[model samples]
Structures are given as C-alpha cells and as structure tokens.
Target: MASIPTILTTIFLFFLRSTISQQIHSNPDCTGRWIHIRRLPSRFNLDLLTNCSQYPLFDDFCPYLPNHGLGQKTHAKSHSWFRTDPMMLELIFHRRMLEYPCLTPDPNSANAVYLPYYTGIDALRYLYGPDVNSSAEHGLELFDFVKEQDSPNIWARHKGHDHFLVMARPAWDFSQPLINDPPIWGTSFLELPEFYNLTVLTFEARAWPWQEQAVPYPTSFHPPNLSFLESWIHRVARSRRSTLMLFAGGGGVSATPNIRRSIRDECENDTKNGTNGGYVKLCDVVDCSNGICEHDPIRYMRPMMEASFCLQPPGDTPTRRSTFDSILAGCIPVFFEDLSAKTQYTWHLPEEEYGEFSVFIPKEEVVFKGLKILDVLMGIPRDRVMKMRERVLELMPRVIYRRHGSSVDFRSNKKDAFDIAIEGTLQRIKSRLQEVAVL
Candidate 1:
C-alpha cells in the first residue's frame, strides 16, 4: 500500500543498511592483514632467497613479491640481490640488508621509511575474521614482498630494479649481524645504491630500543623506554613537586606485604602524622586472599579512586601492568620506574597535563639511590593529589582496554592490557592520517 516515493525510499534505506553492515563485518584481505605464524600456499611458499631462478620473473622482476617481506624486515643474507650469469635460469639470490625506521615523535622526515616484516600471525587474526584460518596461506608471499619493497632501504645493494619498497620500522632488535659488523648487504638508507623506481609504503613504526640517535624511529612507537619514563617522571615531579611512589602490583605477586604495608602506612600518616602524601591502592579482590583481609571490590577501588596519589610499581619485568589497573581504578599513577609501559601505551595523557594524571621516576633515581619511603611520601601535596586523581578518572576510557572473550556483546571475565594496545594503535594511526596534507 505504500506510494512509489515511499517504496523507493524504503528500498534505498534497506540497501544502505545492508551495505553498512557488510562493511562493518568485512575484514581486510591477506594483502592488508599482517602475517604471523601460518603456512603459505605451496605456490607462494617459495623462499626466493634460496631459489630465485625457480620463480617466474619477467625480465628479472618476479610476477609476485616474495614472502619474507610481509611482517618485519628480513635479515636473511641469502635473500639479497641476485648474482646471475645472464641466462636467467642460473640466477642466485641473497638477502639484501635493509634499514627500518626508529621510533620518535619527531622522526627524521627527510629520508625515513617503515617496513612491517616477520609478520605476526596473531595480530592478523581479527582482520581475517572467522575465516582467517582458512585463508591463512592465501596471500603470504605477496604481503611479504609488499612490506619489503615498501621499506626505505630499497635493497640498497640491488638498486637499478623495478620494485615497490615495503617500508616498515623494525619492532625488535635486528641490528646484530650474523656475519660481520654490518652484515653483507646491510647498508644505511641514505647510503643504498639506487638502481630502481621504487614506491615507498610504510608498515608500523619501530618502537623503543633504538636510542634517539641509534635508530630513525619513534621512541613511543614500540613501547616506553627509559626516556619515556624520564619524560613522565620529570612531568610529575614538576607538577606535584614531589617524588614519585612505588608499590607492588596486583594479584599473586601484588598481594605481598610490601603493598599492604605501604597502604596502611600512608593512611595512618595522612590521618595522624599530618603527612601531606595521599594513598591510592589497586587490588583485584577476586584474585587475592590473606587470612586477615577480605576481598571487597568497592573497598579496593574506592580508596584508590578517591586518593590523589597512587603507586604503580610493576609486578613483572618488561611491562608495568599496575599502570593500567591504577588508571581504571580512578587513581593517578606515580610511575617511579619503567616496566616498559610506554610500549603498551603511546597516546597516554598528554604532556601539559602529565602531572594531572601520573608521576614518573627514573630507574637510576628510584632503584639505585634507595631513598627512604617516608621521605618520598612527605614530598607530594594533598591538594595536587586530588587534582591528579580526577584527571585519571577522566582519562580512564582512553587508557583502559576491555576484554570479554570473542563475543560481540560484552561478557564477564574481562582481560585488559593487550587489547588496549591495539585500540590505542588504531586511534593513533587514524589521527596521524588526518594530519596529512592533501596534495
């Protein structure tokens, strides 16, 4: 009974809704998804490094890019430039040395490049959607070649070739040469001998590990380094005009007496001793138990949420899980040490407001100096502590990552840190792309 106009409009609306749904559900094909630990199809699995002539090459150019190019930069020496006798059948290839970008907010734009290599299979799991496992081997080699050709190094040794540069910044330590001090083909980007028409495409940027000068990548790219910690520490120290605090992390390792003792001491000092320092605590009550203490969710998070100063001492090496917990608990983290938190979070609270959320302390100062805990406690002001606590609560959404299994809908038993990194990375990349000028 609908009129023609109304009927047409309804049809259009239905189509539009269906189109939007498809887009939302669709995942990137193998080309866009990064590689991980998966097998490639027999056709693409060919390691051109060892068998270059076996592949179909058009006037020396392979019809498809090789696999080592997908995830991270390949360091294999045998995959480098091909040494041929002009018959095209006897061509032998070796791994070409390539330079990946370093992590830096203000990277050297003049000649910097990115190359995603040694692709992680786990990272691409979501991109392939539910059927990712079936298509695991679909475009492995092409993706790898895409990464390699897009790299800035551009096979410095094999310059005069028609190839796309797979630019990606290294995520781990790849500078150690298996052979000599700069491997066979290992040459700087600027020093590479140019012999081809190359289009540079960047993968993700290299993270921490490269000192500011050692690598041409962003320090915040991979994770936090001593510098990131120092940056935050200096910020907090300047804002609160106080030394940062430390406490054991949560759960098994975190429920130690040191953390509880610190809490009690801080509460008593603030109440009776006129101690200016405040207290914030993070305890996953469900996971911890001592004969004397009862697990109370409200009690555990309340004091921390209300307190201006929270301690974020990491429980494990290489990462500070406490930083994530403290933020969600609504307390400002006084990060006095580095547990590689920066690697996990890059778009953390900004610098101007750094003091408003958390305080950072250098490893040298906190671990080596060994100052009295009381002296550190007395230094921070109560008023500023409250302000920082408020800031933390405000920034919690951006900082916390939720995990509720694979259900599209929210569920129980959530996991946090790793998911937070993925969300943060996506946001950062989106913001970065918006800044590019239209040509």
Candidate 2:
C-alpha cells in the first residue's frame, strides 16, 4: 500500500539497522566507558614487591616484578616467550591500565573505578602459617585507606560495585575457609564484606561465583605487537600437527580418584599399543612431575606445538595454566568440565557454545562411563577440526596479554586480553549502574 519513495526509505532503514546490529555483535563498543584508576598507597602494591624475598610464601618475587610482570625475557625466536610468573597478573593488568585508552583522571566523569592493589603478595604472609588474626589485615587496611583517600562519590556512589581489583591468584587463594580444614591454604581477603562488593579479577574465579570473574593465567608467550601475533598464528597454522593429543602434568600416583593418572594411563596405553582404537601413535606427553614443566616451559611447548588437542583436566583447582599455554601453541583445548574454562573465561573467549574452538568431554563419562579419549578425538571430522583450529587462531590474541611499550600509541587498536577485560568490565558495570539507576 506504500508509495515507491516510502518503500525505498523503509528498505534502506532496515538495511542500515541490520548492518549496525552486525557491527554491534562483531565489534565491542567501548563508548562512554571512562575508567578512573585510584592510586592505592605503595604499601599495598609496589612495597610488597620490594620485600618479596622476606614474604611468608615461596620464591623471591623481586625478579618477577621487573619487565612489567612479564618476567625475564627469554630467547624468543619463534615466539616472544618469557619466564612469566603467575604471581604478577596484578602488575600486568596495572601496566595495561596505565596504557588504557579511556583512562580519565576525573572520578566524577568515570563509569568505573580501578583499585590496583597487589593483594596476592600482601596475603602471602598468611599463606603458610596458622595465623588467622593477620589473615585479612592488609585487605582490611586497604579498605580503610580507600575510605580515607577517595571521595564519597567514587566508591560510595555504587557501594563498591563499580570498583574492581586484579589479583594474580585465584579466589580460593584469598578465600579462607570457615574452619582450619586445610590449616594453611589461603588468606581471608575475599571473605571480608568490603571485598565482596568490589568486582574482582582473578586468574581463576570460584566455579560457583560471588563477584569474582576469572581471567587467563599468564602464559610464556606475549607477543610484542599485532604483527608479531599474526606471524605466530600463521606459523602455528602452517606447522604440522603430527600428534593428536598433548598433556603436560604430573602422573598422579593415587589411583583411587585421580584424573591425571587416568589420563596418563590412557595416554600410555594408546602409545604403548602402537595402533590401538583405530589410531597410531596418537598422544604425546611432557612428564611434568615435581613441577618440572612449570619452570621449564619448552618441555610442554614443543609437544603442544605438534599436537591437535591438549587434554586439560582439573588440577589442584578446576583450571590449569597450561590451558592458555596450549592455546599459544595453536592446540585446540579438550576440557573435561565446564568450570575448567567453559564457564570461567566468558569475557575473553567466545560467548557462544564452547564447541566453536574446543572439544569438551565430561569427566564423569571418562572416569565412570569408560570413555576413551583417543577414540572420541580420532572420530571427529577433519574439516570440523580444521574449523576449530582456525577459530582458535582467530581467538589467539584475545587470550594473550600483549607486552606494553612506549613505542605503541594509545589508539594502536590491537585488542588483547587486557583490552577484552577492560571492555567486558566496563560493559558489565554499565549494565549494573543502569539497573541501579532504574531502581
């Protein structure tokens, strides 16, 4: 019933709207997401690194603090690998925040607030000893300092919901158990009411979440620039993946309820049988018993580089650092459970189904139902596998933390793990703030 001009205008409007919708789904819109980073006292962050040797924990963290938490640079031939520590995520994130494009000095105009507190090292004092009084002393002191330092408009505006902090350790590291069940597991930093309200970024969040969001663990590979990252992707894509599976972890001795032992047993069985289950020499392994692979990365990296799928069973916690490491090697990850990664890294990785870039085999199916990993993997269509690998290459940059430098400009437009985290956090807070405004 409409005229030709009206029909043409309507069609054009529909096309424009559809194109905009596609763009919204493809590109992350970071409009009006200015972040105000609150300067915490040196004692909470840099001071902890200064006396890293005297901490209640393990190794001297002084060496890890240099190179902006990337750790000592390695002989990066094929990759920009580093002897990166898992304990320096706070600093890595801090450095990224320092170089963030939307960082604003005025808190009044800020959409979110960043609290760069090194809670991991600060909580190290309570990690070993059976002391509960000093468990959350640093965290409690931090809240007191924040209350004294910042304006009421910043934290008080949304009751710490808009404020976030990054801790290199998992939520469990700071979440002290109600009773001394383990006696010396973690500090009580996360247990406090003040910390509960703040949005926390961790290496691994609790499977059942409160406010903690899981980010990627620091892998050895950190490309200097986008071109370097692109080159790595192409190199790995072209590399011959002779092996089907790669596993790097301790062979569990306790056979009663062991995931690793089961995997190791199956892997060894497949390898030993020579041509079992319609496959030949299917799996490769890097024996990581006694923390060998943790220190020497190349042991696992070599195997992962030549493998198609990397088996990622739950370690001490639900997730392992090797998950990201395998991705760096262009190996598609095989997750045993949802909590391991499926539910953890929603922001950085794809938000759609996990099947796009990974293969998930339920742990129960393997442990109880007698599922053979090689059989399942070998059965997948080659085209699907290639598609998954291509998807992984596409997603490689999102999982990585690109090394920050002075040479790169603010609008360099390379979106890595840090950028993803910031964008995700800003959008999350924006929605929360809108809900608050509505109420």
Candidate 3:
C-alpha cells in the first residue's frame, strides 16, 4: 500500500491532468486569460500554514499568517494595516492568488496553470541550518512528483511552457549552483529540469531573460480598493517633503554587506538638513545603525513618506525590499545597480526605462571613482525632481496587493502587483508557445 504522502501526491496529479484535459471543453464565451490554479496536496501549502509557529525564521509566525499572510494586525490613526513580515510573501502570494481575477474553476478553460506551491516556506529548514547536501531535498521531492506524472496532456502539453509558479524569495535562493563543494546558501530548485520551462515570479529575478521575472515586494500599505489607492496617492502628492534625500538603512559601523559602502558612510551622520552657510546637505539619514529596524519596518516607511529620493544601495544582495517600500511611500528610488531595478522588473517599472521613475548612480562611481552622491542628486533640476516624484506617485498602484477578503467585494478595475504579474506570465507563456508552434 502507498504511504499517505505518495497517495495524496498521486491523487493531486490525477486531478491536475483531468482538470487540464477538460479545459478543451470550457466555455469559449469567457473572455480574458483564464488561470488554472493547481491544487497541490496540503503538504505543499496548507500544511505549512498549520505549522507556522515551527517555521525556522520566527518563534511564532502564526500572527503573520492571519489576514492571509499579511501578518499581525497593525495600523496608524484608524487605518487598516498589518505587521507584514518580509519572509511571509509565500503566504501572501498564495492568498492573493485566490483572489486573482479571471480564475477558472474549469481546468479545460485555463490558458495558463498557476502552481500554488509554497516553495519558499518549504525551503526554510534546508536553507537556514541544514547540511548543504540536504539543501535540495524539498525541491527535489516536488520535482520527482511532477516528473512521475503520466499525463501527456498536462506537463507535456507545450512542454510545461504554460505552467507558472510564484516564489516569494529572490531568484538566487532557488538557483544556488550545485557545486561539488556547495556553500551554505539556497536550494537547487531552479536547477531542476521540471521547473526550468515554467514562468516564475519573485521579488528579485535574475537579470537574464530565462524563466524568472521580478515582482514587487510587499509593503505596509495594502489598499482595500482603487478608492483607497487614489486617496493615498493624492495624500502623497500633497505631502511636504523636508529634505533633499533620504537613506533609512544601515551599513555604517561595518562595510561588508552593501556594495555602496562609501555611500552609507557618507549618509550615516549627515545632520545638515536644510542648509549650512549656503550649503545644502545631501540627506536626512535614519541610521538603523545596530539592526534597529528588523521588527520595525515602519522605521523605514514613515521617513520614506516624507522624503524625495530614497538611496537604495544593494544590501547583502543586489536588490532590497526597501526599494518597493519606497515606491509604496511615493518616494523616488535612487538605485546603485542597474540589475536592482532596471533589468529585473521589466514587466512593471519604468513603463519603458528606469528613468521614468528612478535615479541610477553607478556603483563604480561611488565605490571606485570617489563620486559624491550628494553632488549628483543636488545637481538635478528641481523640475526634474518634481516630475520624478509625480511618476513615482503614478506607479504606486502597480506595486501592491490591494484586494483583501473584504476588499474583493469593493469592485474596481485597478490591477495591483499580483494582477500585473499573472497577466505578464500568461502573455510570456503564450508568446513562447506561439514561437514553438511556428517551428
């Protein structure tokens, strides 16, 4: 007799194949891209939620699991908010997908398949403290199940080109190289054969145009509807910013993490806000000097709401969640690396190029050529600054997950990050399949 996990896995694959096979007979009258969300066994998603407190990161993640992974309830002055943990994106993405527009109950109607697997959550144990050789266990297990499916009508259909999944972690977490002496890093999920063809949405994707695409990281502001978003945008536009720039992060005492070490050093203690002897200082720094903002994401957001360009030097990685938080606060981001925003978020930002909403100062200039960031930003015309802020305000709606359980009833045509991501994924898959059909 098969064990429970194996039995459940087989049943899931059976349902998946049948669901997809039946899509051929779905109502053609339905317009728009129909997304077929796969029902993976609870072991992949719901089971993780059930054991949230046991998650490797926090002692108790149950609070972060409420409101559909939006985190513990938090607010400011009668407003609805959540203490959204950065790592809870898997929970958030899965819940938001349930509210995904154009979701099809009938598999045959699906133009694209969304596998709601919690690869990010499932990968924590392996990534945090497990042996390096065991890093690929969860991903390998999931891959084996998919590979065992005998459905020529599902995975084999277009060679899984129409299938997609959302990984809450950065692309690097899943693409850790399988070296003989594997370092203490991430899992080998993307390295597996089963996932290579599928579309993946993450907070930070690789700069390359292979399978992964960058999506916005979640912020404190999850608007209930289009009206709330509009209200916020208007408020931000009317906001009286008091400084030339803002740098609300840390790398001050030590310079090992961020590539823009010199920038952090320069901004760490810049106290001259308005002017000193006809000299305008670069920024108002909120130095989170000693890991001060870990539990307090607001330590970054409140200041960002009142500042212009927010300096976003790469931290530990080439990208930072602070970038999206800046956008949510209507602050134009100052990027140091092209890959941090320019190339990774092609599906959403700029509408064309990074210049449409951000400012980029090459890391080389700051690290090697000894260029002063203050001089560069202060040199920009006031008109250009206002225009950039306006662009950032306009982009606020595209970078959040607005529709919560109650908000799903608050009907509006606005598409948030999740919506844009799904549409983009479907379009990319369709484009690829068309090219294949031509051959």
C-alpha TM-score for every candidate? 0.37, 0.87, 0.86
In terms of lDDT, the best-performing candidate is: 2
* lDDT score for residue 218 of model 3: 81
C-alpha lDDT of all candidate models, in order = 0.32, 0.75, 0.71
Q: Across residues 18-108, which tens digit of lDDT does each residue of candidate 3 receive? A: 4554444344543658777765667777666555556455346565665566755565452445677667777677666654556676555
Better of 1 and 2 by lDDT: 2
How many steric clashes does model 2 contain? 0
Model 2's TM-score against the true structure:
0.87
**For all candidates, what are the clash counts?**
57, 0, 3
Best-to-worst order by TM-score is 2, 3, 1
**For every candidate structure, what is the RMSD over all alpha carbons to the true structure, in angstroms?**
19.2, 12.6, 5.6
Which clashing pairs does model 2 show? none
- Candidate number with greatest TM-score: 2
Off by over 4 Å in 3: 1-32, 55-60, 76-79, 129-132, 147-152, 255-259, 268-272, 276-281, 289-291, 406-411
Model 3: residue 255 alpha-carbon error in angstroms: 5.5
lDDT of 2 at 413: 62
